[model samples]
Target: MPEILIAALSPVGHFGPLLNVARGLVDRGERVTVLSGAAHEREIRSVGATPATLPPQGDLDLDLLEPDSGREEISGIKRLNFDIVRLFVAPMPHQAKALAELLTQKRFDAILADYGFFGVLPFVLGERSARPPVLLFSTTPLMISSRDTAPAGLGLPPSTSTFGRLRNRALTLLSQKVLLRPAHKAANCQLHRFNSPELPTFLLDVGVLADRLIVPTVPEFDYPRSDLPANTRYVGMVHPSPTMRFRPPVWWQKLDGDRPVVHVTQGTVDNSDPRRLLQPTIEALADENVMVVATTGGPHVSELGFPIPHNAYVADYLPHDLLLPKVDVMVTNGGYGGVQRALSTGVPLVVAGNTEDKPEVAARVAWSGAGIDLRTGDPTAKAIRAAVREVLGDGRYLRRARELEAAYAQRDGVAEIAALIDEVIGERAVAP
Candidate 1:
């Protein structure tokens, strides 16, 4: 059996696409082992792969990932850069060592890793003899250097102005030098005992070094840039496993009346102040002719102390595939998965909250004319109401979303990704 190791950081929202890919590889007669945090063990085992647990290095909190937070008291882009380096970049050595030990025990043929796990590549791919060919997987849209696409995680516009160009150049330089370079060096140094080659930027050094770069998004949803590396290929979106089966409550039938249904969910992680947003949303649409379906994702739905309007249904989670088709508008925190789901269903969006990569995703949603990206701070009830009304009243957004949906439907994501994996295995002769 050809053995493959799949490495992921944690069991958060990003794990789904990578898990789906691993499951596909396992189904293809490859022996697959998953290296991830303890929280993900059950999820890994559910896919019929052996789970190798990494020790708890405290909790993997998303708050630590946001650059804007804590900046008011603290100043300087360099300080922010140092914080990111300390929190994320400095952990590469420990992660690389753990992954290296796991690989030695299993003697795997190749590695399939998520972008966050790119840190492990220098250790796994550096030494010619001990090293195995690698494949990189990105759950989100692949970023290209040339076109603005939607701004890499910020809402910054595409630059022609000197200041914008300088800002862009500085950010890119800082990312390459202070962040990626050090992590790559750390991993290479850890593998120096085996005479591993020095690595460059994790994306280019390992991506070019890798046999293939598998992006789990379709070309239709994201336009390909001419500057994309030769090794890169878009494999379409990996449909996530349904977390829980949803049976619409009896009151769901009442929602089928005259009003159009609007679905609102802030996704799992980025909804820290769900009540702050959800309450206002419920109140804003109370007198309106729209029916709202709000998902609190297991948090207290009544935290804002607002009365639940008769027209709104509140729940912890809703099966988006089932619910999206029935919804005319989606209000969310701009999680890529949920946004893509809504777009696939031909429903327009009202995006709020600028956490994580959300501001960038929200900007894309607005730019595409498929939705409105409301500002996170001071997102008053009036703004939510106006955005909701605009999406529902204007037919253009729906038309644009339907256009994207047609494009999405034409692409067979699963088949395309499966074919790519088959080609990779065939090229390397790695099979169980």
Candidate 2:
């Protein structure tokens, strides 16, 4: 059997999508080994992939990275910069060492990595002959620096006009030199430790150096980049495990009523505070004709610390695959996977989030004309009410979402990804 290696960071956002990829590769009869956090060993094995735990230095609690002393004083962008360096860039040496050790144990046909897994950087940046083909898949928005848009985290949309392009260039330069220079410098320092060459572009754009850069989203949802690298491939969203069974909430029958169903979530990671998005959404639609379905992601409904409205139902989580098909509008904190999953089911959105890659995901929701972007992490009840009303009242959002749904249905992304892996392995076999 041809063996394949997969590497991912410990975070759910980074590991979840790659887990699906491992499942697909396993289904295709590839002997898959997954290198990720120790917590995910069972989940990896459940997908039929052997699990290899990341080194202690590489497996970190990202939530603990937040500064407890003066967290309120740090700006969002500054916190984001700190996270990129600490969670992603700083662990490069340990990640690379673990991957290198795995390769030494046995020869693998190919390696599929989460784009944020900087451990693969040393080998990819070194010699092509030294390691097997490495393919990096973007789990979030494509962060590759481009002339058509501002730097990734800024959530700036694409602009082709002269002034817009000029603005993009200026911001790109500022981000590369000032805003993100620390991350770039840290990446180079790690590369030096590995005796690998310094990256040619911004560290986030390093996907260009991989043998193949896989973007699982459709082009309709991402900002257009004329200069996108030829190595980049869009294989659409990797579908979740086929065996995932959904047990609906007791109030699930409420969805069959005449009232429009609105689903709201803060996703799993940023759900520590109900006030962020969920509280406001519940308050916003309490009096409306809509049936509100709120998911706590992980926390219990009692943690909401408030009275549940008569029109609303709460659950720890209702799988998107089951819930989205019944939803007319989704209110979210803009996690990429949730947004794409919602769109895939022809559901429109009301997005309000600024943390992590959320702003970028929210911007895409609005730009694609599939929903409204409130552009705030903590939206007011008034704003939530208005956005929900507007989305429900408008036909355009649903139309666009349906268009994307049709597009999503046209391709089996997981199968395509497996084929792409075969292509890479075949090419490698033929190389002189």
Candidate 3:
């Protein structure tokens, strides 16, 4: 049995699936330890694995999972760039030092890193010959840019024409300069501690650095990419954290009612203000002939502090597995896990988000015809209602979403991941 160390980005979206994967590793007879933020120590332990903390950037790891006490103040692509630098790149030196020390102190046979764990760069890329093999997996869509696809962060759709290709190239360069240059500079400064050189870019460059990259969505659902490297394999969905238990609301039976059921959420991180997605959605569809189910991520139902629509129900955290199948349309902030869950269940979406990787996710949803993209972080009730109506009235959206559901039903991806890990370990043991 191999001793495996898994480094996860300190957010529920990233740690949630990685924790489940850690449990899978344990089930396969590997000794597993999860390295992440202190907030996730309990979750890692709940999966019957050991927990090791990542270096804290502050009293808490300031990733996307942090509450948006004042997120509304930040806007524009430049602001998004600054946020990434603030949360991820600025803390790289500490994270890299902590991770490097942990690796040297432990005798792990293999390493699994979340794509967001940029701190692993030093151990994997620095002039260290004693490091274990690395396998990278993304809980979200692949953020890397390829010849066949547009650059990430631009929220652009696919293009096969000469003009479209030219446009993609322009966006790629512009994004690198506008949204990533500062972070890249900060990252290179951190890299100097490990004696590594600066990188020209971050998005597409990271893909080239990882020989093996796993994307947790089917190929058809993602924008078509013809030049994916052999090791860039497409695995099935990363189901939500199985350890987080969910209790259905008493009015769950409303899902079976004659009215169309809509599930509205801001996901775990940006859900600080329910008004962002949930409240507006509930208000938009309230007077209409539909049932509204909203989740506050962890806030009590009463924290919403608004007049409850007679046809609406709210909860702190509802299982996507339990809620998606019964849902007619999902209105969300385009968190990777939440969108994938709804799509896999054949539920079309109405996505409105504009931060981090959200615009990218929303673009894909629109491109696939699985949803309507309002293309804003804060969407008005009128816009939400119009988008919902557009999706419900058009059968094509639901049809395409059902196609993805069939693909998602074919596999769950844990077996494929385990097999890949085995092959990596086997080949390593036999090498001279």
On the 0 to 100 scale, the lDDT of residue 24 in model 2 is 83
Q: Between the candidate structures 2 and 3, which one is better when assessed by TM-score?
A: 2
Please report how far candidate 3 places residue 99 from its true position, in Å.
2.0
Candidate 3 backbone collisions, by pair: none
The estimated TM-scores of all candidates read 0.84, 0.97, 0.92
Candidate 3 lDDT over 1-432, as tens digits, reads: 788888887777877788878988888788998988888899888878899888676212554445473545666765766676676676677777777788888887778888777777776675434677788887667877766668877788888688888887787777777667777777777778778766644643575565468888888778886666667878788665443565566898778988898889888877778778888888898898888888888888878978879988888877777888789999999998889889889999999998768998999899888999899989999999999898889999999999989998887777677777787778778877
**Model 2 lDDT per residue over 143-194, tens place:** 8887899888877778989999999999999988988888889889989997
Clashes of 3: 0
Q: Tell me the lDDT of model 1 at 233.
A: 79
Q: Tens-digit lDDT track for model 1 on 18-40?
A: 67767877777778888778888
Better of 1 and 3 by lDDT: 3
**Local distance difference test scores for all models:** 0.69, 0.88, 0.80
Candidate 1 Cα deviation (angstroms), residue 35: 1.1
**Ten-residue stretch with the least lDDT total in model 2:** 63-72
Least lDDT summed over 10 consecutive residues: which range in candidate 1?
A: 142-151
What is candidate 1's TM-score against the reference?
0.84
Q: Count backbone overlaps in model 2.
A: 1
